[model samples]
Target: MSIQNSIETKVKEGFLALYNTEIPTVEFQATRKEFEGDITVVVFPLLRYKKGNPVQIGEDLGKYIVENVTEITNYNVVKGFLNLVIDDSFYTNFFNAIYSDATYGFVSPKADEKAVMVEYSSPNTNKPLHLGHVRNNLLGYSVAEIIKAAGKKVYKTQIINDRGIHICKSMLAWEKFAPNGSDGQKETPENTGLKGDKLVGNYYVKFDQEYKKEIAQLIAEGKTEDEAKKEAPLFVEAQQMLLKWEAGDAEVVALWKEMNSWVYKGFEVTYKSMGVDFDTLYYESNTYLLGKDVVAQGLEKGVFYKKEDGSVWCDLTEDGLDEKIVLRSDGTAVYMTQDIGTAIQRVKDYADVGGMVYTVGNEQDYHFQVLFLILKKLGFDWAKQLHHLSYGMVDLPSGKMKSREGTVVDADDLMDEMTATAKEISEELGKLDGYSDKEKNELYETIGLGALKYFILKVDPKKRILFDPKSSVDFQGNTGPFIQYTYARIQSIIRKADFDYSQPLTIELHEKEKELLKQLELYPETVQQAAANYSPAIIANYTYDLVKEFNSFYQNVHILGEQDLNKKVFRVQLSKKVAETIKSAFLLLGIQVPERM
Candidate 1:
């Protein structure tokens, strides 16, 4: 049993035996720095059952614990707190048990565990992914991994917004302005030497530019702003194209398929480069028409009502929200309709999936609230398992990004910038003296991406981030490269150890060694807590703390030069375990660790 559990059990017995009163549980915290103990028990809480001064109560419990528990050798009472000093053998035994464990902090999912589907990076097809989508993807992928480590089955998935008026805007723009028209000069991704998504995205921007000019011209010709917007030739044509595409017009449908295929190809390359993947993919085009029949069913069941204009809505005013429209007057499904259908479709595809997590931006917090409530009102048993992992926006120093104006920070570009920064900093530090060019480049990418992922993942999801690539790649402080360098340092130590250090040994522990072991003991609990909170920042910060403890030990203790063979072996083993824990924690955050830097 863990020392905490042992102490708690013994303390309860002590209270019952001395005061003749039964206490259900005990509260414990890490002993204060100035206190001479390993763990502190707050005695003030037990005063409810035993009538006495807290300090006296603490003294009595401390005496009872030391007399009964073998692991706890000594104790000191400070006010109402009982500081228990555990024996060194406890720390050594704990270290020995986990020192060689390759997967110490992870749990294996049981055979019958229910699965969870995590949805993220649900990007519109009209534009390539930007900084916002980058955050979404990284957060979703990391959460999925953490959940798996916590012993749950997880499926990573995304829904592509492939069909809409926005997509038609890009198609219309390409047909009207491309050099060869749609059939004349085909601007295929391969020939243009651009990513498929980027190629399509250029046309989207072009459409906006021409649409604005037309709107301006119409306004100059004696039209109101709203009238000019609706009458603009480009806007009218795009609307017509959307209608035709929905009707399955042969020519329009063919073009839509061709363009979306290109975007999918480009998205694959980006997802691969970012080191995130999905087990399944859903497209809006296929799922948009769904939920309409469900609306009729809801109306029959009185879960929804028809408006005077024939629109369908769920009256949420009673639930502290305004009325939310599910379908338009013309029988067109709204975005919420598509999401409802997609969620149901996923459960159908994976029967074991009992819950879902939507990794969407905080802007849509209200949308998800309505979505979940609607699902529950529809009477689905699993509706209660739904969660919205709402995160804040990611902005750069240049300010917020707008996709239409082409001012957004592109994901590919940001990644490339990070790599360049990593290379620049690594060269100046002369850390690649003996590495080959290929090895150096690979290390640079690993460090660069690691920094990017870590910098973002380490912050609370509800908090906004102003990301600066330059500062993230720093070799010192709470950055990814700093933690990575410490891992490499430990690797160097292992390489220099000429004798076998894996044998078990018993010896008096140094304060630094005991401190490192204490930090290591928190890894499993950290993983579980991070999973429960659905936050990768917990794991990220825990890793930073562990690295800090290991560094303190490294500076104060000598491994290779120690005269005692047993002591040297134990220290090296401890260092190895610390590196292993770092690698494991980084894995949960979807970041890579370099063996050398």
Candidate 2:
């Protein structure tokens, strides 16, 4: 249990025993930045019982609670709140207990005793991943990590949208413009392989322009409008191609096989660069047909009915939702169809599985809400286990990122900019020493990727964030690089010392050190709360606070080469311990720290 919770529990027990009414929910307010108290508790909730003068009431209750609770060494009433100071022994015990045990502050013995599945980064293959996808990837990755650390068994997966009309647009453009341009395997003399997604994407844009022009030109020829459209060759060809591909036409399949492999390779490279991972990858080409059998069974079970237009419909108006399309009129499955199938398949495949969580965007909230409700109607009793971890869209300083507007921030480009910025700053400061080209590249990636992940994870999951290329990604003031710098400083401290652990140590616990240790004690509680609520931002915020405190201590206290050698040894050990704690915290938040930054 966390110290805050322990304190809350103690306060609640005392209040409940004294007041006799059902104990009010106890809340331990976080220590204010400028405050000297360990924690502040608002006594306003009990004001009515103490005859309404809030300040006096707070005073009386503060006295009674402090007198009764031995943990409260000293406490006072300020305004209508009780400012309680805990004993240093609590700080000593808490810090020792906290920093000693691992889990980096995550709580154990998870409630509900069930399983969870998290699906994130469901990227379409028609384009390379961009900044929006980066947000999705980091949120999904960190949230899954958070949940797992909280003691739940989490399954992380992704759905690859490889087969669709949009993808066909890219293929069409490629066929018309780049007939023999792509070997897909060819790295040019410059050693640049045409990136699969980009190579494919440019053609998609080309197809749109050329197809529109052709349609307009044919319309100007005074042919009947419907006739002009009907004579469009690309659509006819693309449709025929899709049919052929679906029918196992050997040549078309081979082309698709080769093209998709290249795209996946490009995607893999990007995923590696960004440090995202997946336990499983579900392909639309393979899983698109997945729900047909289940949807059929659902129809038989009266979960769905045939529409007048011969499409399959699930009537949800009884539950205040409109009737939804299940299967297309042409017997083809749409997005919802594939999802229904995937849900059923997952259950059957992992029969002992506890639940599934989709880390999709907020736009898909209606889809999953409807999906889960439909599963319930289909008599899947375990369907209630489904969850949707909906996240908001990421906007830039200009506006919302739009691909057509050319405002989309490509993931590769963003990382490159960040890496270059880190390198530029490092070089200007003359910080890196004797680094080879490879080492410099790797260092840039570590810091650069850390910057990106930290930027995305710092914001609350529900609120949309506006990214300022300058201020938002800066290294100082609650950023990942700041934490990395603290880690490196600690490493430097450790490297300069060969201290004796066998000697008996007495902790003087100076003001800054005590406050820092107190904050360190809060780590486990922070992790538990963050993991429990699926918020990595909490961990991010805590990590920044820890480093900030460490920096304060670093500036004031001398750890190495202290006049008192024994004190130097103790501070060195403390520095080592802080480094260890920060590294673990960074890992939990899905950021990595370079040994030197």
Which candidate leads in TM-score? 1
> Tens digit of lDDT per residue, candidate 2, span 217-318?
788988777876667777667778788878888987776776677678888888888888998778888888978887789889999999878899999998
lDDT at 138 for candidate 2?
88
Backbone clash pairs for candidate 1 read: 180-185
- Model 1 misplaced regions, further than 4 Å: 12-25, 45-52, 180-184
Candidate 1 lDDT, 250-273, residue by residue in tens: 999999999888888988888998
TM-score per model over all chains: 0.96, 0.89
* TM-score of candidate 1 against the unseen true structure: 0.96
Distance from true location, Cα of 129 in model 1, Å: 1.0
User: lDDT of each prediction vs. the true structure?
Assistant: 0.92, 0.75
Worst 10-residue stretch by lDDT in candidate 2? 181-190
Residue-pair clashes per candidate, as listed? Answer: 1, 3
Q: Which stretches of candidate 2 lie over 4 Å from their true place?
A: 31-36, 47-69, 107-113, 179-192, 222-231, 300-302, 397-408, 434-436, 469-473, 501-506, 561-570
